[model samples]
Target: MKHFATALLCGLTLAWISTVTADQKPNVLIITVDDMSCDSVGAFGCELAETTPTIDALAASGMRFHYAHVQVGNCFPSRNVMFSGRYPHNTGVEGFYQVRDTQYAHLVDAMKDAGYYVAIRGKVTHSTPYQPYAWDQDLTIIDGQKQHIKNADSYYRSTKLGIQSAAEANKPFCINVNVSDPHKPFYAMSSKGQVVKDDNVPSKIFTADEVPIPGFLFDHPDVRKELAHYYSSVRRADDCVAAVLKALHEAGNEKDTVVFFLSDHGMPLPFAKTALWHHSTRTPWIVRWPGVTTAGSVDRQHMISAVDLMPTLLDILDLPAPNAFDGSSFKPLLEGGAQPGRDVVYKVYNENSGGNRSPMRSVETKRFGYIFNPWSDGKRIFKTATQGTMSYRAMRTVASSDPVVAARLQHFNHNVLEEFYDYQADPDALHNLIDDPQYQKEIEELRAEMRRFMVETNDPILAAFDKRHDLAAVSAYVDQVQAESDARRARKRTNKSPQQDDSLFRLVVPKQVQAGQAVLVKIRHTLPKAMAEQQFHVTLKNGDGGRVERIVKTASGDGVLEIEFDVPANLKTKSVVVSAFVGPEYGKHHLHRTKGGIAVTQP
Candidate 1:
């Protein structure tokens, strides 16, 4: 009897210890705001009052990082970097596509493996390979009517459901609540098809006059109007943040949860979102960890990247980080320790949302910023998401009237190859100091640092810097490599079965060819024997002025079609679109179309 009682007591003690250890593990809640700049948050110093009361309160109750940046400025890549703790190049996820390899361990997967219930509430498609990163409870709805967290009520309900589900599972939770506020097509619209005031947006909607304009933009009337709508969206995003935090408290998980609040990237404006400028990659980062992080503490000394988020979270949870991660844990910095030799952060820009190639890389320090624009050969005009906005249209209208605005507009449209900015003196990055002799030494040092980083990371575009003037060659190389990758993926998917194989067709041309020069247009395809000898019509249309050039090409014995055409000497456009079709005579099927255009530079 005595031996049995002793054994029972030991078992009970072990069970109690296990329960305590599980309870000690903190829950994690990440609230991500889309297209929100660091300066827009009230806690980060928005001049406009009440712009972000909820976010401000969160900051005051936690730690705020003043100089945190994302590895890439775009949405998908930035979020991927945060989740994978790797650079875009490393993960092969520079755009909206998923990483071809499933070997990589995701943060949510890691959390789930470590016995935590994981959930993602909004913006489901922003991260790729939905199967590998599948959550225990996915509350994201993509019915086209409302894809993301629509309003405060929906956010509150979704968050509460997530917490409750985790509690029912009897596991600690890690939830990602992506709010799609302030992205585009702002809350309210007017009769003139302009963004106007609406009561449903926010309680205190900012007016055009009350909006604080960034130094990069001209203070035009239309710009202010667009900004007013953006501010209203920002306010709405803040309310969503408040709602999520409220849910955490009401669920009684506030004290045991580590809350993270940040933007995927910067605001969706010119020189901010798609470009490698100051405003492009900077994000507002706030962390609230009860008893671990000091309340109201601010960290301005460390320059952290979105890539570090995964490793840092793992460290905070006392879990081991994967060896594949490029970023190390910044947990020491959060615990009042310094991260030595962490002054500079690197950034990259590949293709935009439209799949247009405008490769850029940069090295940003606390006081200086250097940018390398590989596509800027004086002919390739950079077009991105900002082009569709009303503010850009407004700037174009006033360019002829205002010379300063005209110069700014011209520079924004046609950027030079290299740019250097003293961020301390000019935070807007308006002045290009690359040619300034006073900063020659600084420029060289930054360039060396950038080159070293590229080499260390094995950046595929590092070779393009040497051929900066030859935009066409660089574009061709990138396209060919991507085509080969796609073909390999397709081959694997079809298991090399000829009957099931639909040939991959890619139009390969130099991104930028000199006017009046003979350019080779290669149609690379993997057609089966049945379609190998089929003839196709190839059309090259000027993107700027819509000049068309057509030619009939017969596929060679090995399924390769090569043709040469003289680029029109008097071509008014800077880029050309190459497309092919196998039509009514062969079959009612389209061959393939180039995702983007080929550049045509001046001779």
Candidate 2:
């Protein structure tokens, strides 16, 4: 009896210790706004009143950064950088398409491994590299009603539900609450200038007369009207912020939770979104950690990039990071310490949502900025989401009559080879100093910095940037990239099996097959001599989550191989993907791979 009692006491002690350890780990709450510029928030230098009362209050109660930037200006790539801690080039998420099976771990996976209950409210597809991720709970829908992305009240309910769900799961929560606002279809006013009736409305609406125009845009009446609607949407996003914080407080996790707030990028307007300008990448970053950060403090010395988000969060959670990360942890800066080599930030813009490529790279310091645009050969017209806005239309209308406006329009359409800006004096980036001999020395220094960064990061455009002075070299590189893009588009159009470059690999499958059908997959590859002596593996996966794998010997260094897979009778999806791998064994390190997909017809 005494032995039993002692054992019971020991078990109880260990259980208590475990509980305490879990409780000590702070909860993580990341709130992101869509298409919001740094200057939209009052705490981040917006002179406008009440544009972001809740966000401003949160900033006053925490630490706000003055020099924070995201790696990309588009939504999917930007958020991917924040969650993956890698640049777009490294993650293969340069645009809006899905990148499956990355080598590095995602932030959601890391948080789940650390015993946290992870959830997200909106932007589910945008935040992850691939679709159908295993999140603990998607707070976008609870019971029966869908959580409206633009409805402030829906955010309140969703956040409350997330907190409660985490409590029931008996684990700390890591919730991402992405608020959609200020992007497009902004809060509409009536034709008579009165607020329209809608289920989704901003807490406060502003008039065009009172709206402050962005420095990058001219003060035209149409521009001011659009800015008014944009600011109104910003106010609604702030309401969402207020709702999320209230949920945290009501759940009694305020002091024990660390809250992070920022935008995916700048506003979706001309000279902002989808560009590599200062306003395009600068974000309004705020953090609230109860014991670590001083209230109402602002950090202007260190330039924090979104790529550091994953590493810093992992550090804060006391979790192990992956073997490699492009970004370092900024935990020291959060603790009121300093970090070296934070004086400059590198920014990139690859493709847009429509798969249009306008590759750009820039390096920025507090006072100066330099951009390299190999795509801008004075002939190619730039296309972006902002070109669809009223502001762009208004500028087009006046350009024919006004030389200044005409010049601006011309520069916007066809960018020069290089651009140098004294951003400190001209925050709007209106004046280009590329031809000014007085700033040539500074430009050269920035060019060297950019080249070093590109070389170290192994940027695909390194060759182009190095030969930027040689138009023929630049043209050749651009043509090669364009061909690749065209090939991708052709693949989509044909819906046929893919053939790799140099005729080294090809995969062919049936155009359509029915349920329970025997599907034939054909592969032709020129394997290396070493691999020819080893085993080749093939995996056939149906869209319904069914997988079949096979292994065979590589008969020759160059030949064709055929395999068969049985589609499950209960298949529920409309497609299947086949992957061929050459390696020592199946599920091992692979030397090469080729993948293709086929259509599945219903029985």
Candidate 3:
């Protein structure tokens, strides 16, 4: 017998390549959560009770949605639009730099080029070019003296060592996890600082009269003691999503995993994190995908985002989603079918997380929402970090004895340039309806569908929202498109020069400043040609913690410096962090470091 039929045809071709790589790959997981709040769970209508029994048993074994949003309501450009399925004006990443265009293809580099095994854990600096999501087990600990894992027995031992290293690399994994429990400095203490507690963080806390508040805030008692410490940090992010789905059912890969669960936006309060408001870019998506979603289903007729989560997980792993993805493929609303042009849901709010700009734009629809703002002119004061919380200082101390908390703290400090709202009769967007008259034909059909989706998304603020009905030609076309986009990003940072022992500073100023106004900081640099006329120094610092200022200058000879300053006529700071340098001790040659917030307001 010719060597017994060539060793039984090499053992039937290695058992048909291990049964077609274990029945064509599956395991993904995801999880996410930071800042949370899409009605904080319990199958989304969370009016308290067990505040999210493991995200309502992962939305009772998955497929929740009900209008999922988040294109950008902060958090590293809404997680770089869920790993670059694109948007933040096509991933120039409207905030947080570092994605140096590897020609868009990320969902963990297409699930690590199809073989899978990616990993990750906490925020991990909102995932940037780590060699195309090169994370085979990261466990992110965003600096707080590391040994992280704020409960649920170290999130079930870091999701059972990332499912035993993707089941010992037999592959088919993805992981992610990122659950920094209900964001904002909430709970988690230990290394002798205290607060942590036991049985996976539950010594039952949530009190401030049993929480709830939010109808866009102001229920006082310091907004129910910060919604009882944000519902105990959303019950420690639903016990790290039931310890990563009980480490995917003790690594038997919970019936070939898929998971998902969401939230990377909303609830870090004050009209929800950096406001695009409908509880700030909605969220709580949920999913599951075991025999393709249908467990306790809900969908609510298509309206997705977070840039359709990397083409619906590359159309549920059958892969191939690249035509430079501006997101498509809801995988027919995840197989329960019905996508039909997926009606409305668009939002944006450029530069926040203190790199202040405040732009804002919106669209919504499933009974209108609208918005627009463009830094609402009445002296721009929308400072962030939820305006130093405790429910915005208990609604600015009962805003002069409450006229509905002084018109909701004057629409959270000055805002009103078209707002609209109806959200099926005010879903907490407490009445703006852009000058009512029964919503002037749904505000001209949502301002012509937000100017045809900002001129089909080429939106660099679509020529200042197409000169918003002439506010002096939208402030002279937004100051000539921000001085030709800052002289084309200062001639692409002076033709990228730097590195003979580097040096290329930059301070530039004015994104809004008022208190007696004077401004003009500039400072730019490029040195190294023998430190070209060095002298520097700068400083500034007020980012609402007031007083710092300093000055010094010099650099000219093709190294620029400028400087003007003034502003301080009782400046009570709202922003202005700057900082610069060139040796001789002031942060000894530190150069530049601004990263947003120059606002200042109140003249």
Candidate 4:
């Protein structure tokens, strides 16, 4: 722990080469929202009754990049690409925040290296890694908790202070204010309305009947109401966006600032949050540039993805984009020059919240979207999506009357299918072109593209699963899991069913995560078999005495699990040894694949 900190601290002098003299370089302000769609804003032709005068003005004040799409739609993946300047597929990270990539060069480190004051408000996945990279100071832990509050004002105030502090210190500034408020179960509404302890209450609740359903999701009046509430959250987010723009202008830095507003993925729901489908991975991107971009102009014909943020930002700043960034620069499009199509925009989907699994890969272009279905099971990829958002009462109501609904609800508890789509003709992607004979030529072409992508990216999953087809190899592997399963049962295990043989586990600790806050560990698993009958446990140890343990038993087949806990003040520093174990009584099998020490952040 001390070694990495010393390493970072020792290198502070070399981290930056002051460029304050470059008056032409624009100040950068990136604001990312969660679970939002391109169609929600008035500028995007939103048919809803939401008020987004702030965002509309942002579009009007600077340039609006209409074709601005995110790299990967899921929260973690989207932010990974944005901050690291690497494609999500290439970074080898998917849904959930557990997957850790410590080797990559984060934007904070790079910007600081180039003589910029990097102050981040709000949240950017990996921005404030519980572990450290290059932030100058830490915030006051809100409510005496080890964690800082994820608030909208915190972001704005932090940015304002960082900018002021930087100028006072005579340094160029690059600030990122991340707001997790308008995210799920919007928490930012208290200022505008009566405060509620539960985050589930809607800030601007609306009935489902009021929402114009996107074609991708099945129509239900409740779904429409949910959509309405979702738009309300977007409006709340716009308010903060307006505030940030105002601050930039008031500081006489608005014209000098390069602002970007986007979401990690679509809204959280059946077709929205967890898929590689157009709705899942696509985003509404509005980049407000003072000089480089022309105002009120849209770029529909140009296809852009989230992975491009890093490289594009560097390009706009007239700096060299790192070779490590997988995306190409589209500053040309932003400049109103010749618009060329990206050869391919790659995307991947992994574990959903609470460990539900549905994985797929996509290769999208201006005219086509070729999907890869490595798992061609009997069900649809998005069938179980609605279950996540449905309440227990709502699910029980349907379960008693309709067996089909009962069955779907049951399937929703499991994982299945991989799909392909033709986004051009079927822009909404209602019809999947995977098995259609008419599109064989297109299918083959897409297959080649997918294959080449896997080869180039060197994805470990594809590399390991290439031709290993058979239930037997996995079946035997299950026997090992069964031994552990039986031991767990002996210890009063309630979870039962076949256990998955393949699950990639990693331990993540934040740099600034206090000595008292619980550590959150994320795991990605594939249940070639079910595990309703068994329980799993992950444990962490530091040499001998100080240790932590977590138990997880999921009702679903495939998914990810996050276990958070508080650490003792005695266990100070920023690193710890973590191990994953399953079963009971003399542990028949243990996964010790990683002897690696997890990282911790020292704020």
- Candidate closest to the true structure, highest TM-score: 2
Residue-pair clashes per candidate: 4, 0, 4, 35
lDDT of 2 by residue, 1-603 (tens): 223223322331221111224447888999999999999999898978989877887887778889999989899999999999988889988887777768888988999998998989889889999875767777886542456778877887888877876887788899999998877767774433344676777768888899888877888888888889889999888877777776776687777888899999999889999998999999999987777777778998998899989999998777899748888888888889999998888898888888888889999998899999888988998889889887898889989899988888998999898999999998888999999999999999999999988888878999999899999898788778767767776765575333433445567778777788788877777766664454557777654223444546464578888888787776544676676666554324344554434677776
For candidate 3, report its TM-score: 0.31
Give the winner by lDDT: 1 or 3: 1
**What's the lDDT of the predicted structure labeled candidate 2?**
0.80
Cα lDDT, model 4, residue 245:
56
Q: lDDT for every model?
A: 0.75, 0.80, 0.70, 0.57
- Global Cα RMSD, each model: 18.1, 12.1, 26.2, 14.0
Q: lDDT score, residue 177, model 2? A: 95
**lDDT tens digits, residues 310-345, model 4?**
788888787765457667778887778765556567
Q: Stretches of candidate 1 above 4 Å error?
A: 1-23, 129-132, 142-148, 190-193, 196-200, 466-603
Per-residue alpha-carbon lDDT of candidate 1 for residues 1-603, written as tens digits (9 for 90 to 100): 223223322331221111124437889999999999889998888889988877787787778898888888788878888898888888777765555465688877799989998888776667654333556656553211232454776777678867876776789899999988878767695523375565555645788998999999989888898888889889888777767777776787767788888898888888788887888888899887776677678998988888889999999889987666778788888778898978898998776765566778999999899998866766768878888887888889999899998998888888888999999899899899999999999999999898888888888877876565577876666565556556646755564323322355667777777788877788777655655565667766655223257788666335568878778887654676666765433223445455245677896
Instruction: Compose the digit string of candidate 3's lDDT tens values, residues 229-249.
Output: 678878877766666666566
lDDT (Cα, 0-100) at 381 in candidate 1? 82
TM match of model 1 to true structure:
0.75
Q: Is candidate 3 or candidate 4 better by lDDT?
A: 3
TM-scores, all models, native as reference: 0.75, 0.78, 0.31, 0.67
